[model samples]
Target: MAEQGAPQRRPSIHDVASHAGVSAATVSKVMQGVATVKPANVQRVFDAVERLGYRMDPLASELRRSKRRIIGAVVPEFESEFFGTVITELERLAEQRGYALVAASSRESEAREKEILARMHDWRVSGVVLAPVRNERSPAAAFMKASGMTGVMIDRVLADNAFDTISADSAAASAEVARALVGNGHRHVLVIGLGEQAATVHARLEGFRAQALALAPDMRIDVILSESDVAPLRASLRDYFGKGERPTAVYSLFLKGTLVALSEFRRRGWHCPNDISLVGFDDAEWMQVTFPAIAAVVQPVRRIATQAMDLLFRRIGGEEGPSRALLEPCKVLMRESVGSPGGGARAGGGDGQ
Candidate 1:
């Protein structure tokens, strides 16, 4: 032991290698979890690290590796459960790989999304995971390509093919929802979506429409693109009901829309599956606790997070090939919310004021 006033010498990778009877490079590879490293060497390195209390300096390691040990993640909304779960899982995966994450929410603004990308460039992050906004002309792929930055797109995809993307099979899943609704004997239906700004939403609409029309060409499926805010959604719903005949069932493209629809129905004193049927694209905790459990298509958040990180790291690690689009299947849970269509709005129902 050293004197009280003396500084302690921190054990270095060289010391660990010497104790483990391996080269410094081998120790480094083991610490990095390189599959090429021998199993016995990895065990020895860990044992030596434990015995010597050795800790690698992140800054020095980053400099030596010629890349920052930080990843940037940008999403449309951080408040939503889907994106919140994604960021949490990404942070966990990054920590496991000895990297840090810088997360940002664009709040569904194209300008804000662009600004976040620029900041990621300034920070010289090792890579990015972007869930782009609804703009058709987003320059994310071009910017990343120009800056020699690597990334993976998650949730929503752009038209560009420069980056790998991971998302649920929105079209097929939405089509499945349509099949369920049509099979339940609902001919007239309403589809409430945020807008066509997101490729995910667009895909969902196209899939639902295509499948529904294919099944029953005479079916009346009315669609309305509502603003995501509660008041605007309520207004849109009110206007829809006031304009024409009421739908037997409603399919909301997102969670907020689902909640707003439920609230609107409750305000009118309409019973779910009795007066109107409902389905949503996203699964949420509150959806289950309500009077009637909501039917939803559950996106595999963990799988998406894992796949995005895997793809992003692969790009960062110099993997070269065509950019890939990975789509995971969604699980549809048909709960009590979906049922046979009622005739129309009931007599005692509120005026939806």
Candidate 2:
């Protein structure tokens, strides 16, 4: 029913504003879901936008305005529960402060991370929240600095000095868990899935090793590098168990590593807190709902998200100061998975009843 060769006209906020007899700012406010405008005015704006088929130009007109109101979030994985929660909190805070959020995930690859950062730059985002992968830093950091883009590094430290950073006290958190295990009378403990030379991983390993040495000066620690190498981890576990000198407890650095170790332990019919104690970093959703609740050091996901956004906004507002590094303390959640070292300790199960 439409003419095939008709010239198509691109819609603009100005067109909608003209039709609604309002200012461009009013139309922008309406599009952003600002509640300050009266309902009748909002209806008028919506009607004009619908009639004109006005698609939002997030990069050019709306976001790049002189006020600096668009915030970009770059994370490793959007699907992870921790990052998902962070995104939610950041968006909520940004909305309350009359700013918009544009988010992207790097999928744990350095090249992808650079591509996404470039895209966000084209979007003219005033600020960015990044969780970069380790061992790679180049023109991206330079671009962020030279382009005047205020940035905050979340969950990981950046190798370059271009952005403010906010992360948990990894070393202290790991030390606390190790100390807890030692206090429970466990001497021999194994640390699993610490990657090669990552900033966060290294901090955790250092903390764990420090506590282990303080308690038992000559205690032997088995360090497993590749968490994804399930066969090697299983082989190590089997060998340790078979030698009649099994570690009394295991500390996993990541959720995936924790899951793998737990699955292997379960397959062997070994009970937690009785056969061996367990502690993990980063609590997952199912951990709370499972039969045996796992003990963990809970990172302040919401706080980190909110603070990162706030810092970014301040920087965008021309607040000149030295780049800051915020280290949030983690809380240890004691659950049934950890118990006294000696045998005959009752294995505590979750509230599955």
Identify the candidate with maximal TM-score.
1
Q: What is the lDDT of residue 113 in candidate 2?
A: 80
Which residue pairs of candidate 2 clash?
none
Model 1, 1-353: lDDT tens digits are 67998988999889999999999998877666465667688679878887887777888887787667889999989888999999999997776555789999988777788888988998878889988886324676567678878888888773456888889899998999888878778899899889566788899999999999999898899888865455777898988776765898999998888988898888888888889988899899998887678888899999999999877766776678898988898988887787777643223322111
Q: Estimate every model's Cα lDDT from 0 to 1.
A: 0.81, 0.74
How would you encode candidate 2's per-residue C-alpha lDDT over 118-213 as one tens digit per residue? 888887676788876652243455567677776888886633456778888888889888777776677778888645555778888889999878
Per-candidate TM equals 0.84, 0.75
User: Model 2: residues >4 Å from true position, as ranges?
Assistant: 1-68, 135-139, 158-160, 227-245, 344-353
lDDT of model 1 at position 131: 87
